[model samples]
Target: MLLEGKTVLITGASQGIGRAAAVECARAAANVAINYLGDEAEAESVVAEIRSLGREAIAIRSDVADPASAPAFVAAAVTAFGGVDVFVSNAGICPFHAFLDMPVAVLDRTMRVNLHGAYYMVQAAANQMVAQGRGGSIVAVSSISALVGGEYQTHYTPTKAGVHSLMQSCAIALGRHGIRCNSVLPGTIQTAINKDDLADPEKRARMAARIPLGRLGVPEDLAGPILFLASDMARYVTGAALLVDGGAFVNLQ
Candidate 1:
């Protein structure tokens, strides 16, 4: 088991990539602390599944956007699993809106959930890890949108970019403590958040055609990379933005 005896805390873990990562971590023998915002049932389901795999799991209700929620949840995880060895900041919101038409509230909400939330989580997790003196890994779930402009994601892109920057900065600051900080930038993964955009067959086909891999990624596709980053395999890696985009970024078309 790659993560045997490690405790991993994952935010937005009720569904999609976050859920997948939780399952993967459990499979690797890591006790999981799954955090969700509103969906209690979904969160519980994940917890059940992890328990069935013979790994300890707990469902924590927390809105990462809330300033206090990050530390509170971290403390909760500590109470449950001793300490956090890995923190995956996967909670985020992406609302598509043109720049000119984007409302102030939407932009602010996006920043609250995506940027500020990640910052708080990282800070809290780093503090906990440092206190433990065992070092740790922090992986922010970023997006390829951070590297390229999105016609409908003017506000969303910046938050991801900010998250990427946050990881890089933390990598430098936390290295002395033996903590590693990095990010995983997933491309067009079919998740509930983007279900509508992908529901249109024409739109989906067009999007797939642009990717060199000829298919959209799934939540499971990103789990391995995330697990690697959070495992001892990446002991020397930090300040990295790994692209799990299926070659979409390099597709000239």
Candidate 2:
């Protein structure tokens, strides 16, 4: 019960990594604010599962990419859970295209949702944590793409790289206030992001060959690390980027 009695707000909690994080928070005995931008039914189902675990949970609709939406989200979480102990910025989009032919719209949407959304959401969440006058944790879901540039994922890479920079800068700025900021960079998780690619046997095999772990990552695989970073287990950790890539980031022979 590392996070017993803590409250965590996770965006994009309707499915994939975000959903897994919500369940992990409950397992850690933390009440959860599950935020989703769409698929209300799925979000509600997640809340039900959390409650079934004997922890408080609620679904809130929010578009992370919208500037006005994050503060409202924080306000709703404060109303429900007294205040936030952890905030996970998990909502993002990936639209891959080669640089030459990449559409401007794809770039704009990727930057808005992945980078700008993280900035504003963290701002709002930190405001709440600061006003509470208690130390808090902030975790952003960055990508391994931030570390190693991927081909055809140009639109996706820049935003994730921005996230790493954001985490470091925010951690330094907020440390004195007892606030910690960090990012988790995952590689080739078996989520909606890689569904289309994995559908192709060749692409899947190629990806597996690169991963020393011998398999693609599951959303559940990321849950543990995220929970640890959000809990007191990682109290001394801030201004760090933990790569949960199953050796994908390492040059393992």
On lDDT, the candidate that comes out on top is 1
Give the TM-score comparing model 1 with the true structure, all chains together.
0.99
Candidate 1 residue-wise lDDT at 35? 86
Each model's TM-score? Answer: 0.99, 0.97
Clashing pairs in 2: none
Off by over 4 Å in 1: none
Per-residue lDDT for 136-207 in model 1, tens only?
999999999899998889999999999999999999999999999999999999998898878899999999
> What TM-score would candidate 2 get against the native?
0.97
Error of 2 at 121 (Å): 0.4
lDDT of 2 by residue, 1-253 (tens): 9899899999888999999999999999999998788789999999999999999998889788899989998888889989999999999887667888889898998899999999999999998889999989999999999988877898899899999899999999899889999999999899887787689998888888888888889999999999989999899999999999889889556
lDDT of 1: 0.95
